[model samples]
Target: MSPFAKLLLVYDGSAEAQAALERCAQLSLALSAQVDVISVVDAESANAHCAGLLSDLAFHRLEELARSTLDHAVRQLTGDGIVASGYVSFGRLNDVVLRHTQAFNPDLVVVGHRAQARRSRWWGSRSAHHELTERLGGTTIVTVTLPGT
Candidate 1:
């Protein structure tokens, strides 16, 4: 083991994402690790035809939402006596996440796994979280299971 001191937490603002943030807080406390919370904006989807007109203001709003989500996660961790740093990026979710992991070089990555319907699974409904985890290389990634499953 390389003495894990940094934790990278990925949040999507979902209930499962919140649970992952809570788990990150607890783990940070237990391991005395510094946490970097991240949110990846799916810009590809935002540019889709059905996404409506996305102006500069819309992108700004998305940035604001990402910051707010990261802020909330940081607050929760700090409230629990775990100090952490936060970051947000806008791009393809998987690419954004991978770039962040490479840049930050965290020891562990945390994410939430959304349950997929059978049909969806067969249709390749894998989430960005799972993709990022697989691409994390040497970093250990933890997937927080969905609640009530």
Candidate 2:
């Protein structure tokens, strides 16, 4: 395994993701790596119930929120002298993450893993974290579980 030169962090504005961000910041500082924070907006879920009720302005607002979330994460890391940048994309979470990973070719990617819910288990219990770990060809995947279980 080569030393990490670039790190990609998948942020979802969750507590778990924030924990992962801290870990990434530590690693980036230790290894002197560049960090790229990405947030994927699940537009499918956003449009599911609302459908046409969501105006173009509303969609743009959501995009702005995503960008702001990523920017905040980047600021947290960069404040400690870690090189960082942020990006936001609207699409399937796993697909967008994978595509960005391919484009950036980062040495490592970090994500947060949520506990499997009972409903999800009954419905075949799969998640973007699993697909990302399995399908991301060259990038190493690091799934951070929240502290205290």
Candidate 3:
């Protein structure tokens, strides 16, 4: 039996995420693992950055974008003859992902990691991939990194 029976993929429609999706598809086929894909809408950050009315509009748009991104990912996987599930949520990236990770209890978590800029890294906030790896003790985390565009 394959060691990984279930897989969770964190996708955000980025080029890095597309690469991860491709990688996840290959892994799923090889292991015959069940796959769950997720995209998060950070509505809290949107509200904090925008004014009242603007915040509402931005949050709505963010949700729409997240939903579409996740749907497209699921469709792509399905087209490849892989049965997968998709989820869209609003919250901090790592938090939302962790919540789903707990619920899904995947044997493996696959996420695309784009290295943050020096300025952002200097701020001391870790990337979602970093946080997820730390928070998910014992669960195998596979991070696919892509060079900056």
Candidate of highest TM-score = 2
Please list the Cα RMSD from the true structure of every candidate, rounded to 1 decimal place: 2.0, 1.8, 1.8
Least accurate 10 contiguous residues by lDDT in model 3: 50-59
Residue 112, candidate 3: Cα error in Å is 0.7
Per-residue alpha-carbon lDDT of candidate 3 for residues 1-149, written as tens digits (9 for 90 to 100):
89888899999999899989999999999998879999988877766676544555666788899999999999999888888999887789889878997888999899988878899989996888777888888888889877554
lDDT of 2 at 37: 92
Which segments of candidate 3 are over 4 A away from where they belong?
51-54, 147-149
Better of 2 and 3 by TM-score: 2
Model 2: per-residue lDDT, tens digit, 1-149? 33899999999889989989988988888888999999987767787858647777777888888988898898898899998989998798888988888898999999988888889989996977878878897678888889877
Judged by whole-model lDDT over C-alpha atoms, candidate 2 comes out at: 0.87
lDDT computed for candidate 1:
0.82
How many residue pairs clash in each candidate at the backbone level?
A: 0, 0, 0
Query: Of the pair 1 and 2, which is ahead by TM-score?
Result: 2
User: Ten residues in a row with the worst lDDT in model 2?
Assistant: 49-58
Please give the CA lDDT of all the candidate structures: 0.82, 0.87, 0.87
- lDDT by residue (tens digit), candidate 1, 65-149: 8888888888888888886888888788778778887888888889887788899889988876667757777778888976685
Name every residue pair that clashes in candidate 1: none
User: Which runs of model 2 end up more than 4 angstroms from their true locations?
Assistant: none
Candidates ranked, most accurate by lDDT first: 3, 2, 1
